[model samples]
Target chain A: MRKTFITAILLVLAAFTARAQTQEPEMADALRANGKIYVVVTVLATIFAGIIIFLVRLDRKMTKIEKNN
Target chain B: MRTWWWKILCILLVGYTVIAGFLIPVPRLDILNETIRNLYFHVPMWFTMIALFTASGIYAIKYLRSGRLQDDIYSAHYAITGIAFSVYGMLTGMEWAKFTWGEAWSNDPKQLGSAMCMLIYFAYLVLRNGLKDEEKRAKISAVYNIFAYALMIPLIFILPRMVDSLHPGNGGNPAFKQYDLDSNMRLVFYPAVTGWMLLGFWMATLRIRLHLYRFKKENSFAFENN
Candidate 1:
């Protein structure tokens, strides 16, 4: 089972890397050079992280309440 | 609905969307060169918002028929989460517009329609706050929710189509998919929509459970006093 799982993972990685090599150049070289693209990525990541943190906090509150009850 | 597998799927799908959306090569067009990639992130926000609001409307209908407080809780949380998604949608759209379109806030028909749709929901929240009685709050808000959602569909989807607009898929402007959604783009786009919808639902469920816990605690407190 472990060997097959590893093989499957390797196959998927190989497929992706092969596709990557054959891929056309991306259109956002200017955005990438200016570092604006990373800005967008950072903003998106931060928002997602903030939301997940909020959910985790809410979950903790509920756990406390359940314990008291 | 609250299965672990689906939540895991949401995480993986969204992770894929973020990675592929930035990295993948898209069909380079004239105006929307790289910003065309915004299709994956910005467009899915609208789809997820609509889906969540639809769920809210269903819960509202259930509340009316069942007269259950739990139903109202579900209805309210879904609407709240939907509103959050709508805000994110509008913000991302404005940011994307700043690049593609001249300004962030063009008085486009779709923009106007989006504003109206959001205002209607804001009115719903304001209406809820104004009422002090719980039973009256649930019943009236349920009716209003159904009415607001009914209006929301036409305001966002139908009305914009009738007029000349800056937004794509309406007016003279060409849609992103008109150039063919490119199987490559579809790979990220479909998963993005599904992932965001699932994430929105997950947040709504968390809020609903939190509200339920508070409601139960209050009930128990009252029982103890009695």
Candidate 2:
């Protein structure tokens, strides 16, 4: 079961890598487009994800403090 | 978050929207002519919906993992926001279709996929309302929200892409494809996406804040009585 799960994940990663490779030459073309919006979307998404991470950490600290109490 | 930042951000966003929204692209299709302006509204609405729902689905997964009520609240708002986007997309598509296709609506794969997605989330809301217990509401709603959304992305984005339709950038049309981005259009297009995404984030944060306030108030009330 574990082997199968590992293999499945590996296959998924391989497909993603392959997809990225296929998109590479187009990367030059994509870069040419000056897709400022994509950058903005990506940055905003990262910030939101960062907030989630921070919240998780804060929750953990709160839990520990409560346990001490 | 408790500062004047939101008000400032909203003012800037609305200002940008008015300026960019009217500066409409010189119509790419001769037949469509100025009809291309529909894209400003159509694309942004659809993108916002997708972003909001994605945020919701993420929350659903987290809620399931940690059994947190706050996660459930965020998930619900996200689902509703996704529905709002789907509605805007459908309506905008209908108008565009009427102009371009000479018929307002058709059983297109993309349309059907969107309808299906909206229905699933609507049912999710109904499912949540069915349960009275807080824990059960969180558990059942979280499970269904996750399941429905897992099915939603592929069925709407992926499956529809596999089939042809009147829509551009789908099936085999490169006209609307990302690769077709002309240098000129990219100037406006990319920022348009950013602006729309920012707006979507803005809405989600508003919804989340309202939820937090309600949750805090309710728990305090519960604690007081206890």
Q: Which one is best on lDDT?
A: 1
lDDT of 1 by residue, B1-226 (tens): 2245776687778877887788676776666777888898889889988998999999999999999898999999999999999999999999988988889999999999999999999999999999999889999999999999999988998898889988998877667677758888988889999998888887888888889878888888999999
Model 1 chain B poorest ten-residue lDDT run: B1-10
How close is every model to the real structure, measured as TM-score? Answer: 0.82, 0.70
Q: Candidate 2 chain B, which ten residues in sequence have the lowest lDDT sum?
A: B21-30
- Give the interface RMSD of each candidate: 4.6, 13.8
lDDT of 2 at A35: 61
User: By TM-score, who's the top model here?
Assistant: 1
Q: Mark the regions of model 1 whose C-alpha exceeds 4 Å error after superposition.
A: A1-26, A30-68
Candidate 1: CAPRI quality band: incorrect
Q: Write the per-residue lDDT of candidate 2 for residues A30-62, one digit (tens) a residue.
A: 332676545644665566456545644544554
